[model samples]
Target: MIKIDDYAYTSGLKDVHPVEKVSFALIFLLFTIISKNIWVACFTFTVMSIGVLFKAKIPFIAYLKLLFVPFVFLMTSLVAILFSIAPIYQEDLEVLWMAEIGLWQIYISSYSIQQSYELATTILASVSCLYFLVLSTPLNQFIWVFKKVKLPAVFVELMGITYRFIFVLLEKMNEIYIAQSSRLGYQNYRSWFSSVAQLIVSLFVKSMSSAKELQIAIDSRGGDEHLYDVDLSMGYNRGHFVIIFFSFITLFMIYIMTKS
Candidate 1:
């Protein structure tokens, strides 16, 4: 998670207008789902992967590790879908195959495999689109774009606070883990579990303490309701917008032809 934020801050495309990136990511994401075409899914995944690896300069190994997580889950779900149990199998049944387990039968229909493949690719493509957005645009810039559109101050404030606090929580968790490791807290399974439970309790107490300190500090400074106000200079780039617009248009046209 920290590495994701780090890449967003140092991305080569960070200088580009956040709105343009947002528009591109969202538009393509919608098309990827709506088209419901395997080709479109492949296209969307390829485009976003290229942008993340080449344009955003994320390391290839790191990107693979990120993708490996979802890929494993996808495969697991697909495997689960490829089998089912019934009380018995009819000799005239039209299933691809079947196996007996005592008085029960386990089998998979061709439709289940087809549906799983379609759903898995669709999920992968949509996730890739989101990955592109977050990797290229940090939370600050994302909130800045929302602020530009005059979103409610309270909503923007919550988003900013939530994002910042995520990093704070991660930092605190890391510190506790390192300290525990140094003390042989995870030398055995029993000790590891105890250490993890303590870590959670300790983190909660620390977080509450920090929040109280922050509240006192803010109260001292007369409190801030509009604290999310940040100045960012972002201009709409017609060239980037045009490229994205036409790219999706062409992609849709191909979908139409291939779909028919």
Candidate 2:
């Protein structure tokens, strides 16, 4: 628990509110949609990297590794799109393969390459921003920030309970699996499947009981009125809004200037 708390609260992004982090992320997405220009995307990425260091105190290399997993699809898509949209060579312009719509024909122009490169970079940069945001912030803080944004109370409460219980269920499952494995209960494939099936059914029953108990506990403590008693503050400030607003403006200008 201590280790988990340390990882959660002191991971270099504790000071940034979840809403601001999400807002910065949305700006990245907007940039991606507006321009496929490589230079603009690179500029946005560089700015975002510097901002991460200043605002979140995250080491660039550490966060880069965390982002690698989410970027795989982006990288693959960029490569495929770049190859598909790239212009044909002057000599190869007339060289057509068997008739397939849009596949064999090439435009053979400088603009094609520029457009494809721009699009690829925009996607990659946007994906990187989202990945960094998630790694830097804690899950609980996300829900807290959502409450202030006027998210439905029932939805928030349900999400919170689900998030809290998922870890609990994982812990219980791990204990059961370890004990069974130690006793050679999973020596055969069939036995392992059966054991897992039984474990899931058992977990479901326990979760249902736990939910009932939680409902009872809440009812005993004043139920629907509980949200009125809880303090939810919309903690926006000028600095936060200004930073986001300017970032959006700059990115929008870049998009307009470079877009095909």
lDDT (CA) per prediction? 0.86, 0.67
lDDT of 2 by residue, 126-208 (tens): 86676556655666676776777788888877777787787777777888889788878799999889888978887888789
TM-score against truth, every candidate: 0.91, 0.66
Error of 1 at 34 (Å): 2.4
Count of backbone collisions in candidate 2: 3
**Relative to the unseen true structure, what is the C-alpha lDDT of residue 206 in candidate 1, on a scale of 0 to 100?**
84
Model 1: ten consecutive residues of lowest lDDT: 85-94
In model 1, the runs with Cα more than 4 Å from the true position are 90-94, 221-224
TM-score computed on alpha carbons, candidate 1 = 0.91
